[model samples]
Target: MYAAAGANARACSRRGRSLILPLRPLAWPAVTIRLGHSHEADDVFLFHALTAGKVDTGDLQIEPVVLDFQGLNDKASRGELEATTLSVHAYAYARKHYRLLRSGWTFGEGRGPMIVAREAMTAETLAAASIAVGGVTSSAYLAMTLWNPRARTRVLPFDKVLPAVETGLVDAGLMVHEEEMALELTGLVCVHDLGEWWSGKTDGLPLPLGSVVVRRDVDEDVQRQLHKAVSESVHYALANRQEVVTAVRGTVGGLEADLADDFLGRYITDLSLDIGDRGQSAAEEFLRRGCETGIIPDSLPLEFAPSAAAEPSSSARDGARS
Candidate 1:
């Protein structure tokens, strides 16, 4: 970020704003957060602020870094990024390589994976049968394993899943997140909702999707500042819906209002603040099972720092649900 026109102004580029919180002031080093399937609105608010200069660096400076939906966690592990959006599975995988700073995630009520067959779910399909799936840590894979522990699933990048499904390369593709409903246009039918299935298996609780994570090796104050600023930015972006829509179009390629609106509504958690007791517990149970089954190792901690979460804010009271 630079001062321009002798007016002391910052440039505005992406949809997100730079963290300019008043409470904590420091000329912090700029850091990058790789986002793939994070809340598009949050991404817009943040990316625009950091990259395009819409937001100022009052206490901290964050540089917006973009990565493919699949490469986010990988980049963080390689030290290519200090933070990134991660699926629970991706977080588990990355923990083996990097320190993790936990923040809010985009989980929702009853969202889950769909088998996504253009045709039909046949009983006999087995070896050599293909299925289009999202990248390594995507919720789709999480759903696949949870739904049927015995099945072996293949991991594919996000953009390629649709084309692969359309071409019949995979007999079926597993779809999750917002695409569970959106993929109907491509003749993709839902064989199951993994989140819903999980709910049935363990009562009513939102399925944990992906989260905003930072490297644990960073300074403690930096993490605290990030936690507060990011929380505020997301809340502020929700207040200015039009700005977020404009930012999404400008930064993330597609900017159609309907798509942007839907994306925002879906990924932006009304339960956006802290990981509630139930949510945290769910993470632990999931990790326990995932480790026991060899889906991931047990070294990962379900609670990154439970004591660090501050008291709940009134902002979420606006429309706090899932």
Candidate 2:
């Protein structure tokens, strides 16, 4: 769980504001929560405010660490980080150690991971083909398996998937992140958007791709404050779009300004601010499907921290009692 790193943090970038000094020193020391997020453009844009010290964290300080999405999921499983971004599939196993934050989640309406191939292949033919997948633990991989259990898979890094497909290393490739926007440059054709497929199955519910999780072991008050701080960061970014894009570009080199803006526009939405009733239902559906297909073992119940005014789950009530 997150604990105070020290009395003060190494000051953040000069571009943003610093923490406000307290009128008088408090008896308690300030806590610095270790935060882990992905290197994708959306995450970089969403987190710019928090990492740049633009949001007031109350008594808490957020120490940011950037890692690949798949690696963050793996680390979350081990409880290695106090707070981190994790794939929903990984969250299923770590439900005992973490509580899904109400905000900072990625859900898609009619867009998500794409299956790209050099040659046009219909969905019916894709069922029998071997494809390159980013990672076994990725939400994309889970979706691919659920979508086509019969297709064989070859694991490759996310960036390598498109190149592998272009070079004929695999029949087709599953691409996530910015690859969806760059597909045309590779001369590849998108066979299917998993998000659209999922929406069709669930009557237009957004696909719950990933979420932010805070260790359950932390004090409830501290966790709530940290959660609020995170939501504030996302709000700040939304209000300051150009700043977000510029700051994000400086951090994620080679990320075109336009692509970064496109990513922010796509991922950071109503769902990113708070997972409402609709998003909650979507999350449950994703987990239910995972369990039904045996991708995730049926063990812990899905118990996320609901929006402040939303109803709580019976499991959450039971957890509070114990």
Candidate 3:
């Protein structure tokens, strides 16, 4: 009778174990997201908050894939990353694989890519001369071609473009990013400011340069989460500008605190946090013009990841309009 009682207890224990197993919560593994962006100061500043764990990313683990803008653009074209910063020109090709995020755009209101030469040249002469561009798919190149269809171009690494012009290998180099700010030091003269020209052409719409995009295959919920996280990151960076700038100064060699602040100020404005309707119109118009010029094979409808929080605040909208 004792043995029988023990057996009965063992059976009950087994049944209890089975019943308890079904009541336990499931633990899902964290998902790793590969975020591709350029190594420039502005890009570094925008992502510093998230990368440093200042923002709440929940289950998403962001892995930054840092590269030059062109390399990022190339990777975007191949659909190699979960998220990436792409030149507006390259987005035309990558739009099929990715949807642009509402945050993390670089728009030049009136100052942008400039054509620089060792010596001053007339617009007609510069248009007819050989120009070295960072990449054929760079927004600078597209704008250059649109501004002057007759200009000839050769592709070179962005850093090498200035050197190529200095050595007289190319009559001019289209300067973008920090290079655009270094013309005075390099003894190069600006032939044209593409942003200025674009503004004039588009009735003062800012020239969209770089934007972040997420792969379409990502779950909609995760996309929204990521967008919110990025927006938070931007806000964090802005709120703690001095701390973020000081942290990122080492990334770009010789980047003084003042210069870094100025650079970030130029690119990471309200639009970086949430690209408003005007910013959207500017991107659409840019791609539309690319299609009309036959530089881009075709344009895809711009699709943004859905996030209720992604809508621009009134201040952002007003700032974008300004």
Candidate 4:
């Protein structure tokens, strides 16, 4: 389903403003768009409406694919899914096949990924110790790289990281999502909060973690509709919080009710709807930092589908051509 015109559009309009369109709309039959998301609770909550037929998808039929963030990132890299949630770090590699949608983002303010150890560890010791990371391409790993470029890492499933550290397999682990809450029961101590480190480094900018990306080959109108649908879905989930939480139905696994509420509040609150100016700046800074550290090859320009109220920001427009 890749399109030459779409690739050209991506190259020509990296700023997220003008989209290169076909001379005329191509005639195509009804299609089912494969949408990918993580199994995490916030992801489940945000996407519940679309999966449950609570939102109008226009003419597109969405078939949901739920997996770990790393799994989704892998699929996105190969362009196997039409749409999916991906770590912003992974997006650096997958930007060729997909463009970020404006809605359905996960950003952290004062709180973010944590480096946890079974026993207290100092910054110097943690930097030299082996650590379990959920994914090599995850934002958590990216943050760790920036925080401690000398740290040694091993990739494990996000759920397995804590256990690996508990058993002394790794000296520490970088964790996010529900894993953040599980640290206490595992008797792990937080050595460093990457979000806090990032916040201080960037003057309190939110940590841009994950975002929804759509395949470039998809029609522009379909992409816009998808963004609108996701925005509405988040709004709906917030409005019917109880219903959405109930719908998740133990998806978070052993998380206490209070902790589940806290998790949702932290990840999906206001930033889930649209990744406004602050989020965009955070993303740009991440790219800049990642590039400076050689964690990623280069800081690619971000191209998000335009929202109703604005065009892409001036920074986006200025750097897109590069």
User: What lDDT does the true structure give each of the candidates?
Assistant: 0.59, 0.79, 0.83, 0.81
Model 2 is weakest, by summed lDDT over 10 consecutive residues, at: 1-10
Compose the digit string of candidate 2's lDDT tens values, residues 57-149.
776778888888878988888898889988877887778788889888887777888888988887678887789988887777777778876
User: Model 3 residue 124 lDDT?
Assistant: 76
Best of the two (1, 2) by lDDT:
2
Candidate 2 Cα outliers beyond 4 Å, as residue runs: 1-25, 306-322
Question: How far does residue 198 in candidate 2 sit from its true spot (Å)?
Answer: 0.8
TM-scores vs. true structure, each candidate: 0.73, 0.85, 0.87, 0.84
Model 2, C-alpha of 22: deviation from truth (Å): 16
| Candidate 4 ranges beyond 4 A from true positions | 1-29, 306-322
Q: Write the per-residue lDDT of candidate 1 for residues 1-322, one digit (tens) a residue.
A: 2434443544455568663322323232444433333434445543443344444434455655555556675675565555566666666766744443344566656665567666666555632356667765665576577666766555676767777778877777777665643574687666556777777777887777766676665544555556665555555566666776677767655456777676667656655455667767666666666788777777456535222534433343222212
lDDT per residue (tens digit) for residues 1-322 in model 4: 2346545334346577765555544434445789999888878889999999999876568899988888999999999998999999898889889989878988878789898888887767877899898789888888889988878888887678889999999998888754676667888888899999999999999888889999987766667667877888889998998788877756656767777777788878677887778888999899889989988977468987645533334354334323
For candidate 4, the TM-score is 0.84
Q: Which residues of candidate 1, in runs, are more than 4 Å off?
A: 1-42, 45-57, 96-102, 122-129, 155-157, 178-182, 253-256, 303-322
Q: Relative to the unseen true structure, what is the C-alpha lDDT of residue 143 in candidate 4, on a scale of 0 to 100?
A: 86
Q: Among all windows of ten consecutive residues in candidate 4, which has the lowest summed lDDT? A: 313-322
Q: How many angstroms is residue 30 displaced in model 2 relative to the true structure, after the best TM-score fit?
A: 1.7
